[model samples]
Target chain A: MKAGHRHPADDDQDATTQLAGIATLARQLATAPPSVPDIASRARAWRRRQARKLAPAVVAAAAAAAVAVSAGVIPGSGGDSPAAVTAAPAPAPPMQTVRFLSSMASVAAAQSAPRPDVFWYERVADETGPATESWESTTQTGLLRAADPQQTSAIAPTAAVTYFAYEPLTFAQMRALPLDPAVLAARMRATLRASGRATGEHRTGSDQEMFESVRYMLGWGQATPELRAALYRMLATLPGVRVLGQGTDPHGRRGSVIVVALPLGGVRAMLVDPADGRLLAAGASPDDASPDDASPDDAASQAPAPAATPGGPGPWTPPADWTYRGPIHYNVIFEASGYVNAVGRRPE
Target chain B: MRTAEGFEPWYAAEFPRLVASLRIATGDAGLAEEAAAEACARAYAKWGRVRRMESPSGWVYVVALNEVRSALRRRRLERNHAGRLRAGHAPPPADPDDALWRAVRALPERMRLAVALRYVADLPEAEIATAMGVARGTVAATLHSARRQLARELAVLTIKETP
Candidate 1:
């Protein structure tokens, strides 16, 4: 008899009894499920990501239409038959990066902001030794337990307020950042320009600087969820940003990676957890050489090859050897972060 | 033609069962929850189309399974790299004392998946086939083989305990 088909009545009954015991054991393993609000937030993030992924195709079609109209070859635009008019090639859209950031924004927006009196505590680890823990309060008071034995612990007076790239911001300034992406981007640009003039630095308000500023803010700055979301949205709009697909941090945590092409050379890669919008790791590689030319000594060059774009014609593979080769200069992973009531207290 | 209003209850009812089934299938609590939540999120994102399907739960099961598979693939690659760098930092093995769980986990991946979808998710053979991307007969055969193997394992355990 067929496996699922009924055989003798006794044999069917015996199988049913065995299956029941297995089902009971399986059901015993069930734990409490995640809350609905959490899943709903993820759904919103997924929707935003889907929208961003479609943006490139939409832009390409619009560009094609504009070219057709200008050429006077569009059939409906009172022009000749559309024959051999070629549309200018559209720049590859950073679909995965945009989607990942958009998802991060959604996840960030769903989180509760830190309380007024609470300190933002974080544990960070580098490629070297043990993890170090730090706690920074809004009042610019904090404590740091460094991994180095010589200076193991210290009272940090100005931990909370730091530069968002070249533009310095106090905790208050970070909290008061505009929630709208365009408005925030403009404000960041203005601040960057002003700071550049004050410091006599010629290169300010560049996309690379802006990208670094956003990365710093998202990584260490104590911005509100609204501001964090806004920063992510702003980052999505920046040029020269590309998704290098998924990768694992030093601590073996999985995350999606986004790389920003530096103005001078090479790329800055950041790994972020899409589930919670947390910055897992950030590093930079100084070589623009393709993977084929990558030296075997390059240890941190474990980035996955370009992934196929979802629902697109073909994979949006980065220029050959877009994967960074050579050791990452500033590789660091955030082990944990949370809010605590006091400077010395760690999150439970 | 179900509206977004209809998704709330459906999600609430199905999410736990999906997680439980996935937990059994993958033998990793964290992965199961993450995959199930992601699948439900995807379903909610495209509810207009998913709600109209013949089996929304089946679709969710398929998506969750795919997520688990992708994550496992990534983990394998990461393990290879981690092995070269560090000596021993692998994830903890699943529980060894639970004979039933051990038997289930010992089954082939496809058989384990079939059993989980059938027994834990309480899905019919047809839906299990759809979710697993196998024909119905294959699912039936896999489940039958799994049940027979599980029965023998449990019987030996029982005999050992009888002393």
Candidate 2:
């Protein structure tokens, strides 16, 4: 070991012996390490895969950067202003993402607040199992039913309303949240700090977490049209958020994808319907695998195979023009959500 | 950017060690190979930058560990989702037939990673800390705790097996 880099077992003979024994066992397990092929060939293959996956992102980023340069908003260019006055230059937001989100905000704003209903119903499914249907009432009671017949239906107290960092909120508290994007962003930061869940100074992870929280509120919380609009606008201001072009949900619905690049190599992607601005699906994908390149075994183990539409079609496949990105780890699709009169009722 | 010439020798030397360490860290051999290959490919892609680091091997370790973590998180989420659908469903426990390996595998996730890096990768606490993205002190504490737990578990196993 290098000087000043002591092993934990160095001080104790027994610990050292134990670690050595463990090391020996580990070595025995690895006696025949998997054979490696030609390094150059492997590297070449990897480059090809990555190029195919990253081409769209590279083109989109280049276009956005070009637009920023033309607009005199060069990224990472520190101007002549005093250091105190001049904040670090932020990455230019992807122009296409900005446009799509701005449109989503407008669509959200044009809609009126939903009428008060006794129950809120949602049908959701993830790469886990069959779809789950839940009906929650304002009275803090709810019923949950799984599509699988073997699973027993559950009737329990509803989960508390929460928003932006899982900070519990009452209807009054949610209504009092600021509407301006900057102010709302500040409020969210404050909420994250106060919740005591924020750890480390990793800014990118915190931003990604905040984005997910806002998405959760938009999908399930009782956000009014006005609040939803503000939330969408706030998302546009977050650094590292970008457009991953178009993609399809598990249900075969086509939507525009906006992704937040995770600090570690991957992305948290949300797909939104272009016409209505409703969120269709959300998922995370590692940097290596393309979204549609998930192995059959992995898909079968994790996600329920897409069910055939009653009389419409079979499982959806990506078209030739589909943009390939990263491998999806887990995808949650929001099948439907609406106010309802009672338990077990779905939106028409 | 360092030319591909520099990457070939380093890749040949470090790849097997990385896979071995990752195999211990992740109980799944297949995941270890996949993560190691992926991390090496990434390193090769960014060889110019990675070669300038104090320890290129340390960088590869971090990337491979992150890959393993992402996969584990995905599996956990899927399991949780499956658990919800099938109420009371639980994932199977790690294999208990091999007491030593079982003890190592049974350690908390962070502790397991620390142990694997320290023993299998032969990394010092400082490098392990960097790879795990924790403070050096935290790495020492984690390894210390893991050692004690492993010793106790192995002792118990030995006693149980005594005729």
Candidate 3:
């Protein structure tokens, strides 16, 4: 670390370094910030208050030296979810994924809602948050028919970048087993039940059904750190798999532990038990596999993604250095496309 | 009151500059404007007193700066700090300051106040003291501590080259 106070170094050099840092800082401050009209109005409202004492200024000299560049506000969604701020999500447009909302109709909560009503999901601990789409409102998440099959899930926004204790299975271990989907499902069930969690019959979403007529199941339970730790160990035993970490479930299962793996194309995440090592929630990546293969769309029907803005940041690569920025908050993920549509500050 | 003539033109002339000031103060232009607006509102309400002041624009600047400080403090205090702390412990990407704000936001109320006022907002020690209601000496120390903590945590960040 530089000394806390350097003895009088030549003022010129010291001044120069400070100037450059300030200049660079000013350039960055110019990004287009969210245009929140309400916040603006509220601030203006404060003008009604009494005169408070004045404060000193950042040196005027510094302001000029600080800005090598200036900022301009622009229009268009960065589609940069809060996650994009924390970690640059790969450059892929948000897929229209709400179709999985119909899968919710089959969920017990959805099945119980009043007719003319949709699901009734809430933030498990902090119920004050937005109506959880997958578990609650159709407008928020589209419509999910609990009666439908298992859904194709992308990583839910709230669950991504989050960690939990997990039982991981290594690819080597899995290669030795039957490795069939039923066998995999049974292994998952036995593992979960042992960890004080339970799994429901796997269900499928319309998209998942169309994917390959594969039988996919979905379930939920509480996830704890201890459970996650166990999941980490167990998942390491599965062949062709590696557990990265864990995350919570969007459906509000605190006991649900998430696991990350590189099974096929890109890094895929799976929710598993830290205690018994059962898979709970899982998501696919277009990187590991082709987006074309993953999509249920008839190529002819899908629209091309919007073009990138000109002279904007690069074709959406990670910040040369991944700097965690914020719009840091919670996200609502669409199951069909795994695209995050909405976000709000973490509620009290 | 000075009938609004003394400063109306100046305030209008300084709008863009003031916007820049608030922008830096709040990290986001949108938030900065809100703070600046609040400060202006306060100025407007007290225009009689402000009109007599040496520099009415300075008065507005002070108010805006205070609003910036207060808003940031509130956000740090109210935000979910747990996830932030956990993320802070993780390795930072190449640009530490980009990620530094995240960890800074996760800090306890006082620490966050000290850090943002000093660095993110880049307010001077005297201004921070005035904004935070602390002694100038305390602002220096607070700034020192905040910098130390961030430097320690982001030791790995500065080393990574930009791709």
lDDT of all predictions, in order shown? 0.62, 0.61, 0.34
CAPRI-style docking class of model 3 based on DockQ? incorrect
- Clashes (backbone N, CA, C under 3 Å), per candidate, total 2, 1, 79
Q: Give DockQ for candidates 1 onward, in order.
A: 0.18, 0.18, 0.05
Candidate 1 regions exceeding 4 Å error are: A1-15, A57-348, B1-3, B74-98
Model 1 CAPRI rating:
incorrect
Per-residue lDDT tens digits of candidate 1, residues A61-135?
Answer: 454355445656445543354433322233433676678778879998998886655566777765445566665
How many times do residue backbones clash in model 2? 1
Ranking by DockQ: 1, 2, 3
TM-score of 3: 0.29
Worst 10 residues of 2 chain A by lDDT: A296-305
Ranking by TM-score: 2, 1, 3
DockQ category of candidate 2: incorrect
Q: lDDT per residue, candidate 1, B76-149, as tens digits?
A: 11222222222432342344466777777766667778888987788999999888777999998887777776
What ranges in model 3 sit over 4 Å off?
A1-24, A27-348, B6-29, B54-124, B149-155
